[model samples]
Target: MEGLHHDTIVDGEEDDSPAKKQDSPVEEELVGDVRIEDFSEKQINHSLAPEERVNLYEQMVRIRRFEERSLRSYQQGHIGGFLHLYIGQEAVAVGAVSVMGEDDHVITAYRDHGHALAVGMDMDECMAELYGKKTGCSKGKGGSMHFFAPDKNFWGGHGIVGGQTPLGLGIAYALKFNKKAGSCLCFMGDGATNQGPFYESLNLASLWNLPVVYVIENNGYSMGTAEARHSAGEPLARRGDMFDIDWSVSHGHDMYEVRHTINDALERAHNESRPSVLEIVTYRYRGHSVADPDQTYRSKEEIEEYKKSKDPINLYKEKLIAEGHLTEGSALEIDRLAKEEAEASAEFAQASPLPEPTELMDDIYWETDNPASKTSQGTMFFETP
Candidate 1:
């Protein structure tokens, strides 16, 4: 706690862009718009019921542990294929997923383990999927980048740069057309934000008033490219205004800010049937995809500074300890449990068998009204059930 106060603000934002339009104090006062309950400075949050607070903390811890274990396993050559870690971006997952229930949907790029865990997907199942085991979430057909639990409302882990954006919009459109109250959270990195799907998805989402939250995890780099060198406008939050959608930009490292942003976005969606884009300015502590070194893009000092100063888990722990909800022993116990869970997940994946080559013909498709829409896989030409 001695050094906690100095890290209060991770991002020192100064913008003279049109997005920084000043709000009149008198007008805001007349409408009670500045009420603390009504407006929050950031999306990461902590003002909630004890149960909810504990639950959010658990999710973030689970995400951190999951990433740590996965990265370790990848280094040891236990988990094969592309493994993108959402290490420092756990707050985005914990805060956003906390706002939704079973019926709502989620979609994101390859960095998906945290999103799955946040949405109540079993860690064991997720790990099994990563290991390409037959008992995996996608039945081992898809590994780290393509695990889809439709029954769990997880649309998928898309690999294409900005592929999931359109699919997410379609899902939200389907829900709306079907008279369901569910919305979709479409997540992508800052690198993917400039892709065609990003603009196309936003246009259709806002035009149709689809209930979709297009979240840009701005981690300052798209692979080895820095944001300043890669993006024309580093701020993604204000980009939504051009499409006539409401948005919030917040520090992705702060849970309080994330929670506040999610609540606000969902409120606008539920009340007015609108779309939103919540830009979370976050950073990933690891390399882009377990293949490249982040040193090519960022300095070691900056990384270490973020690691020491703005760790989401430590920040939340400090707050909880200050408020007396958490003790040092209890916090350590939580960490122990997270590590144990990861261990169990690894064991489960180890014991599970991989899918057979012939079975690739199966588990690829489901039935539809039109028989022609059925998909087949492998050289056997057997229709995937």
Candidate 2:
């Protein structure tokens, strides 16, 4: 990794100081052009078993139907707060998570319902969380932006931009400290690529050789802003150039490509204790959140075109049918089952109870054994207002 000279401009004037020539080792190595690889036709074939193919299709359909129902529920005023639907980006989560081991950690940004479902989080609990019911995965406290399942190694859906970046590093460090074989997969949006923590976390992960996979789900928009408007270069994978980490771009619509890319990346992470940055080029069918009308920036025609050409569910279904791994009737049956499951989850959420008012203070602080406890020696005391 050789360093390259970058000219600094201030007030429309170029700075030519010799001291500026001393670029950081990371910066120096960031000079080369980034190449995004696409899997060959042969590579995608025979990668998954017949049952695995069916499972992938089912998972993608489940996520799609679940989000569609959630969108309807939100419109009906049954669900409150911001609802970020993961309508079109199902293939990314399902494919990447398909290759993960049982013990690997998964974290992501606010658009996390798909991720939670991909990692086997209960659909009833996820829907309940969105409904703010007590039976939710986060006990109805975290809401849509903070779904967590520690038992499944799903860290959370962080509300803040780029908040999970450093947290992922921390988890990776812990895995390394414990001599664990599993790695952490941290998913973020293209918008998060501009945040400071994204860079900071990557730097440390590279320097420490932490076992983490930093995935940027580039859906071409930072809210309503197009990627071209917000970013200097389109492919966010190059952002990894500054770090001593492997980086690549994968098509988010293709589950096979996503699974293969992530599987290879995890192999490197486990074998060499290295981190990787994967930029999965995907798109969101809905607005950034339910609040924004997505039409202000992009045309409806564009969305329809993407749906026609690159919809993940349709693409995978066609693949399965073509490969003789699934029948058209079976695919339709799977879709029906997914819709039924999602509807049942919504019903369960509706029937679930709300959290008690007194429960507001619960899980807010850690209880510690205080020596000065009045009750008894080694008694636990929790500080309160």
Candidate 3:
């Protein structure tokens, strides 16, 4: 999706137009008024023990600290290409993934560092990927946008807008085909909702009753364009209604709220093989990429206001402290440890080797990588001529 950061904002497109501007709803949702008290004590997260709740808080802090570390690395020229930080939207990935069952799978767009970590990926391998080292998750090839762990059921870190939606549909279809009670949680940004492929994926998902939950992490702005300017609909999730797919909206700042909303959608998928479109209203502090200037589109005050009230880590930390699940000292210690872990991962990445040129074509072919599994009888690569 880094390529999209450089896209020219065309004057008139199918989903975006001057005529559609009037139809777009107000931008009142960006403030994120939802608080911890909004949710009942014995709500969807009732089953979680005190330790488990504290762990969730710790997870959000880990994501924040890791992203902050990566940003620092990027500024210092240790990382290359576009770096999309998940600084403000930690709750959406961590909270949702927390509720995922063993059979549940996940895939997301290029803003994927948060999801990658939430799914139990090690910090060293992930940071190595960003540094383009041989020890990286994709062996230094995939970079920041293409972390994959099939063993963990985290399919990819796709770099295209809405490109993973169909793949997610296929995963859900396979689950249903194998008669397995599972769901594929496909995530995309607010901008991706306007993409044609996403709509097509929704159509097929609804038609076949595929167990895929489409999660739109609507962080108000799609790249530099705000939600009201990019999309025509009131809430992007309502588009799912046209396909007869179940849909709902939730505030992403609160971990408990995120878990509650996503848990329901996952249950729908698990029990009925149905699809859902969950629009989680979130926010992003940085620009589309680390290189992009945020001040060009939004105000500094707006960003500061969000950081003040809706920061997922701070919100969850205060909630846990209030509940007596954690103390201020413990929370600070957890954050301190997370910062150390991120720094250690960066050191490991710096020490890792670069991929050899000879190894370039090694992993390209399944048959080549596994000679014992080769059954083809033709040249796989072309000559220099």
Candidate 4:
């Protein structure tokens, strides 16, 4: 927070005095970052009541704690095989989903524990999934990489990189075909943005004017590979332009900014009936998965920079306290509560049962002679066949 500088490059073509951002009711530009300024507590008018603010604060903390615990469990070997922690991306889910009605849909990549919690999945259930429990959200059939909540209409924690993009658009297609009012927020990573499906999906989504929010959580790295190393001149935000979709970016480290960014994206997708892009530029403190040694690509100084200065949780607390919306003692209490809740969930998850051998066939889509139901997420509706 202290060492960062913000010297804006003037757009020489536009006679730009540091290229100003477009005006909006829900977004603004904060200090030290060129991304969209969030309508933080200070910027918000008498819009949200005190109770609503309290609930929002609690949900963000819960997501933060749930992810922290997931990381710890991953380290301890309780959670196995390619666990991706949503350490820095909590606000993108919490704030986005908070503004969505019950019917809105959310789908994202493997870094999805935060989304599951934000969308009302039980902490016990989430941790149980991490522990591969039979009573888990995905019934222990799909481990950390795949979780489906039909009740929440939270489509997935898809394993294949960039694979979920089209599925989300398909969901939007279904919503439109039925002439129903709904939206799908398809979340992907910077790495997955490189895949073919990501672009193809965007083209179709934009052409059909599908109600989908294609969000790129550009954490600046694909696994240990830096963005500069993996990505071309292709700014992930501009990916939407190929398909003529609306594009925007925000400070991914701040929930306030993330919330505002998604709010705007969803608004466009809702009112305009077209796709949109929001590139949330943030950083992660842990390794790509639980297995890597986390020593090679990035330096200690980089992690320290993000954690000490740009940590999302700290940013939220500082802005709230400074605005007099959250007291110092209240912030401390919230942290205490987050720890207690996380511990309780961990214990409960530990006590949860693992999948029984007999339970294997329970959720299989193709139990009998239906060859069409091969994939877990496949549909068997009538087609041109």
Candidate 5:
């Protein structure tokens, strides 16, 4: 909370000069500070029934608990490669997904377990993916960062930064071309915003007026570099203004605020066939990946402060309890159930068989996996002659 600056660094139109040329309007709000009291009962998660709100709370708990389990697994050397834990940003994924319609889809960066769970992905499959077991969602091909459930309209946990941005644009294009009433929620971290592909995706999204909401989960530090140090422009969502795309920012810790802002963007996408940039200010408790030591860049105090004051799970849980939708006992029960589910998932991952070595080339190509569905001819891949 100390280093979080929601105000845009650049204000109004930039001074017209050869060296000082600036793009887009710069007016921005102090975001990531929206409190639970900011919204009235009628305005906050109003559409959701009491039971549904409790479910949202449960979902957040599940994500947090799952991440905690995964972190422990990573520490125990059960997980390999990169394990990007989504410990602090549960509300953003869960709240956004809660407001989505059936046709709506989701795609996000490598820190995707939360999104996966939010979209109804089972914990066993997710944990198995991390464990590189055959039962993984990707059949053990994609560790930690490559979970995919096309049936659920969840694309993937892409390892490359900003690589999923253009793919999200394609999803939007298809939805529009097919005359489907849906939008794609393309999520990325603050670090991904600096990538070239993201800007390209934004350009086309604005140009074609695709129904895609580019959700930037700005969690202060991009990897180890503080956001202020890594990015030049303040309030990264304002970049949307250059392309004439509607953009807004909000606190990611508050589920109601997350739902409100994301629903607004989704409405723009669905109704006007337009794209929007919704930067949900969030924070991560872990490093960019499990391998990186987070202490080098960010102080322990800052992380602790966020955990104590702005934890999404705790805030939502408290809100639900205050509203009489959830009692302390119910909250504890929900958390206990989440912990049990997480532990069971870990056990499932451990007991699950590792993928056989012979399956290396399997699922690599569509034609290879599904001969009946293969319409294209010719050698898709080359074998040693």
Candidate 6:
């Protein structure tokens, strides 16, 4: 189950010339000529209740504000380590997670603030984790890259590229074994799509008919390398064809379209025990990490263009206002509240304490008497023979 399938071969590795230049037919169909202008005219589906629309907008705003504050904190030296901001990819996480139930699982890559917030992890704990306080979701041991809330079924924000793919399969298998009415959402970056584990996981998921959806948040670049420079096949979603898994590519800027597509994928996973691949075309406003100078690879004009024309928050706000679900004043109020909340969380993190020395060994092992329970000390307890 862990090994690679024959069909999992890299597209252009054999010839080493260039991958036969071609557009993915599936991507072309799924992502039609829907431009940024279409969002203004796109009617809000009646199925999406008025309250739900507000909630989606609020969640996206909250994530944006939090990431903005996190950047400030990093610059001010309050938060350390590599900081990967989820600034521009808000729609993908919020839209997709909105369709999921409490029982469903979610896991993603290092740039995970949006995923954690979208899945309902507390703002305080997430901010605290970034600040390296003991109050973090991983008790502060895991930094910006590792936010885990098993209680909320958010497995983690893994640091390794494509590492979460296999773990996602294991979760899906467990859910099916227990006959749970839920599925797993395994999210990875465009960079991760090139790794072997991604292909291997897809092979197993399709072979076993596991209840999982592998989402590639194609933000155009893996670190500093753009997708075109790194990925062999342009559309990562088509990789699923090798395993006979249903796959589609979609614009992540539009919340409604993203929500509906993910909802359908989750439905198929939960009821039919099928898996799918979703390549979400999104963007990140900042560099790969806070440390990297994003200007070297791409131009300032490119970033400004995306922020001005295709920002998820701005588009959704306009949509809500156009549909009469929200007013300009009310939308501004939401943004104000989100900013206040994010600031409060940063203050809370600054006031929180660091982990104690004794806590270093905590969560390292499980007691033999009760293997299910976590233990700080790795001590053995057995009766004499």
Model 5 lDDT, residue 194, Cα: 95
What lDDT does model 6 reach? 0.81
Model 6 clash pairs?
Answer: none
Q: If scored against the real structure, what TM-score would every candidate get?
A: 0.85, 0.85, 0.90, 0.86, 0.90, 0.86
For each candidate in the order shown, give its overall lDDT on alpha carbons.
0.75, 0.80, 0.84, 0.73, 0.84, 0.81
Residue 373, model 6: Cα distance from true site in angstroms: 8.3
Please, what are the lDDT tens digits per residue for candidate 1 over residues 97-169? 8877655789999888889888788988899998888888988878898878787788889999898999989
Instruction: Tell me the tens digit of each residue's lDDT in model 2 across 1-385.
Output: 0110011111112223221211112211111132222342424435666898899999999999999999988998989999998899999999988889855789999999999999999899999999999999988999999999888889999999999999999998999999998899999998999999999999999999999999988888889887767878535666787785778665677787688778777877898989998877778889999878977888887678678777889978877897798999999999999999999999999999999987776775433223244354452436443
* lDDT (tens digit, per residue) of candidate 4 on 285-359: 777886776678877776786777667777777777776788889988987898898988888888887777767
Q: What is the C-alpha RMSD of each candidate to the true structure, in Å?
A: 6.3, 9.0, 6.8, 5.7, 5.3, 7.5
**lDDT by residue for model 6 over 58-159, one digit each (tens)?**
999999999999999999999999999999999999999888886689988899999999989999999999998999888899999999888888999999
Model 2 / residue 311 / CA error / Å: 0.1
What tens-digit string does per-residue lDDT give for candidate 3 at 116-235? 999999999999999999999999889998999999999999999999999999999999999999999999999999999999999999999999999999888889998767988566
Local lDDT at 186 for model 2? 94
**Per-residue lDDT for 343 in model 4?**
88
RMSD, candidate 4, Å: 5.7
Which segments of model 3 are wrong by more than 4 Å?
A: 1-37, 40-43, 383-385
Residue-pair clashes per candidate: 14, 1, 1, 2, 0, 0
Ranking of all predicted structures according to lDDT, beginning with the best and ending with the worst: 5, 3, 6, 2, 1, 4
Model 6 ranges off by over 4 Å = 1-45, 368-385
Name the TM-score of candidate 4: 0.86
